[model samples]
Target: MYLTFWGVRGSYPVPGAATVRYGGHTSCVELRSDRGKCLVIDAGTGLRGLGKKLAQEFRKPDGATYNLILSHVHWDHIQGLPFFEPAYIGDTKIVVHAPRAAAKELRQVIGGITRHEFFPVDLDAVPADFEFHEVVPGSAFEIDEFTVLPIGLNHPFGAVGYRVDADGSSMAYVSDTAPFDRMLHKQHFTAGIEEPSDEDREILKTMRANLVESLREVDTVIYDTHFTSEEYEQFPHWGHSTPEHALQICQEAGVRQLVLYHHAPAHDDDMMDRIAEKFGLLGKEANVVVCVAKEKMTLTMGEVTNPGIVA
Candidate 1:
């Protein structure tokens, strides 16, 4: 199995010279089994490029089924769907697995991406057959050669992190979440310093515990590290995590490697380099390998044994 990062930026796309090295596209990743079965995570701006590649690879008349799992439907996470080329191919089938929203159905949430006012093509008019499945948090489900477990996350409008295990190899994707200590986000946003009730406090504790347990000893963890320690204090309720928060969880989970993902839009390549250096040293001391996720970076697993980067 292998994991490829097509996009790493958070909140929004930030294309420019400064962000060229690390990439400016937001939150898309591709995972493939050793046997070549494929599953995608998120549909951020990076999905446009990935879709183009997939269109060429699966151009046969019989077509192919592509499975995509999403953490949540913030604009940055789902904005690339309208441009996904395979959606224009008649024989292709796209299956999407995502967290169940509080008020909307899975299709309604996704189809909104292509609402006529927002895009030229309506989702219903797309050529490909799209299937939507609402994933229940804490439940395990299978997608082709992999087994996935969805764990609830602390994010606005709610979100869930995914742990994928296949062929004895495992990895987890946990992004767009806060540290779970200060805030308990729900379907709506909170305006001020709202403390959790006793009931909500217990829920937060269990949620954090569940996230750690789900990631236990995973080969790799691609996590949201969108804030610096200083920045986190300013916007604790913004639904993003600092590297420290991610490291703390990975340490408790006994994870082998921690890949810093969901880069803040304000962090350019130089800032990312500094983050990599600082966390690299911190991870070495913690006995976990740390890597910064970059666009086009690939991590091979399973038979590969060592999770080395491939050009």
Candidate 2:
């Protein structure tokens, strides 16, 4: 299997000269099996490019079959779906797996992004055959040659991290989450709530434990490191982690490689360089290979090919 990063930015797309090196698109990743079965994670602006590529590759009579697994329904995560060209193709089959909403069905939640008022085309109007599945946290499911386990995350409106096992190798995607020690997010946003109750602490402890266990000894981990320690201190409830927090999880889980993902919009290419250098050194001390995620970066599962990380 191969894992490829199409988008790495967080919050929104930042397409400018300053962000060119690290890329400005929001969260979208593609994982493909040896048999060419593809599973996509998130549908941020980067999905636009991925869709174009898929449109070219799967232009046969049968069209393409792709499964999209979303961590959450944040605008930055699902904003590119309207621009995805494959959806306009009649034979394309897209199976979408997303976190279940307490009030809305999966279609209502995901399809809202492509409503007529927002986009020219509604999701229902698309030519593709779409199937929506509500992913339950802690439940394991199979799609193609992969086994996926959703790990609940600490985020407003709720989010999920995924553990994907394929071809005897494993990779975990943990994003849009805050440090478990700080704020506890649920159905509503918890921006100003700084302190947690005794019960909240226990829940957070369990949440972190589950996340670490899901990533235990995984081949690679793409984690949300959107904030610096200084920035995280100011917005502890923002539901984004720092590199330090990510490293802590990797060290505890005995992960082999740590990919610092979900770059903040404010972090320019130079800032990203500094982050890569700093955490790259820290990862060395912790016996893990660390590198910052860049757009178009591809990694074969169980192999160290990206030169950014010293093997």
Candidate 3:
């Protein structure tokens, strides 16, 4: 399988000279199996570009099949679905997989945003055959040649981390999750009205253990590193992680490579360069291949390759 980063920034898109190197588009990644099956990780603004490229390079007379796995319904993660060029093509088939909601169906949760009041085009009006699948957390399923495992993440309204395995290689994508703070998690569940019981601590521990096990020995782990240790101290409940959090997880999981993803919108290219350099040194010491995810960077199973600018 091959992995490509179309958009790396988190929160929102930031286009300017300051963000030119790392890019400004919000969270979207493409994974293509050796058999040519295309699986998209998120539908952020970057999906627009990926859609156009796929249309140009691979669109067939019968259109193409796209599997989109959403981490959550946050705006920055799903905003590009309405603008995805493939949905405009009549013969296209889009399969959207998302975590099951408490009340609404997966389709309703996603289609709610594309309603007439929010966007000019309704979800039903998209010129494609659409299917929505609700994924249960901690469940593993198969899509084409890839085995996908969805793990619940520590985020508001809940999110899921995905581990994809194919052809003896694996990649785990843990986006938009904060470091598991036991007290904060208890507060989240209890609305800050009371202290957590011992049971709460045990539940949190189990969740963390499951996440670590899901990531164990993966070839590449794309982690949410949206803050520095200092910034994380200020926004502990903001549903994002720091580079330190990422390194700890990767080191513990014995991951071969780590890709720092979901960059903070305010972190300019210079800031990112410094962070990457710092982590690069630490990665060397830890015997892990570490790189900050830049837009258009591509990685095959055994090697990291940057095709540079994607035209």
Candidate 4:
């Protein structure tokens, strides 16, 4: 298995000199199985570039097929679908798997974004053959050579995290989730209670256990690290995690490598460099390989086995 980071920044695109090193585009990742099956994790701004490259490189007499696994329908996650150059090609087949409960709703959401008001061409008019699949959270499915397990994440509109395994290698993509803090659920109980009720505690325990199980022994874990601990304290309900939180999870799950991803839009290259250096040291101490996700960075499974940056 091979993985590439096309976009790492979160929230929105930040195109400027300050962000040139890491990336300006929002979330998107490309994964390739040993058998050459192509799977795209998200369709953010970076998808446009991936599409252009695919158009130039991938040629099939019948049609080029792509499997797109969407984490959610947020603008930053699906905004580039209409702009994807390959979607305009007459012989391209794109299968989009989303976390919507119904397939029709998924189609509606994708179609709504490409309506005449927003884009010149409607989604139905797109030249490619589009197939929408609704994926339920907590379900395991297979696409080509990859086995994918989708787990529910703690986001406002709901999100899904994916663990993909192929060729004896496994990778987990855990984006757009907040740390499972007990304080966040205080509203459901009496304010004076010093500790959560037994039921609440059990729920939290199960949540963390499930997440760790999904990532257990994975070769690489690309996790949401959209904030520092200080920043996460201020925005506890923002549905994002901190580098500290990511490190804790990786350590608990015994993951070999952890990629800190979904960078905050305001974090510049210098800030990212500092964060990477700090976490790199922490990872070294904990015996876990750690790196900050950068645009165009590629990692070949089984090639890297130490705690260090890939690029």
lDDT of each: 0.90, 0.89, 0.85, 0.85
After aligning candidate 4 to the native by TM-score, how far in Å is the CA of 208 from where it should be? Answer: 1.8
Candidate 3 per-residue lDDT, tens place, 209-259, comes to 888999999999999999999988777767788888888888888999999
Off by over 4 Å in 3: 182-197, 303-311
Q: Which whole-number lDDT from 0 to 100 does residue 220 have in model 3?
A: 93
The sequence of per-residue lDDT tens digits that candidate 4 reaches over residues 30-109 is 99876556799999999989888778866767688889999988899998898888888888888999898333488898
Alpha carbon lDDT of residue 44, candidate 1? 99
Worst 10 residues of 4 by lDDT: 184-193
Cα TM-score per model: 0.96, 0.96, 0.92, 0.90
lDDT of 2 by residue, 1-311 (tens): 67788999999999889999889999999887666678999999999999998888876776777799999999999998888889988888889999985778899888887777888888998999889999998999999889999999998878999999987788989988998997788776554766888999999999999999899999889999999999988888788999999999999999999999999999999999999999999999999899999999888776433334311
Ranking by TM-score: 1, 2, 3, 4
Clashing pairs in 2: none
Candidate 4 backbone collisions, by pair: none
- Error (Å) of candidate 3 at residue 20 is 0.6
Tens-place lDDT per residue, model 1, 218-247, is 999999999999998888878889988899
What is the number of backbone collisions in each predicted candidate, taken in the order shown?
A: 0, 0, 0, 0
- How far is 115's C-alpha from truth in model 3 (Å)? 1.6
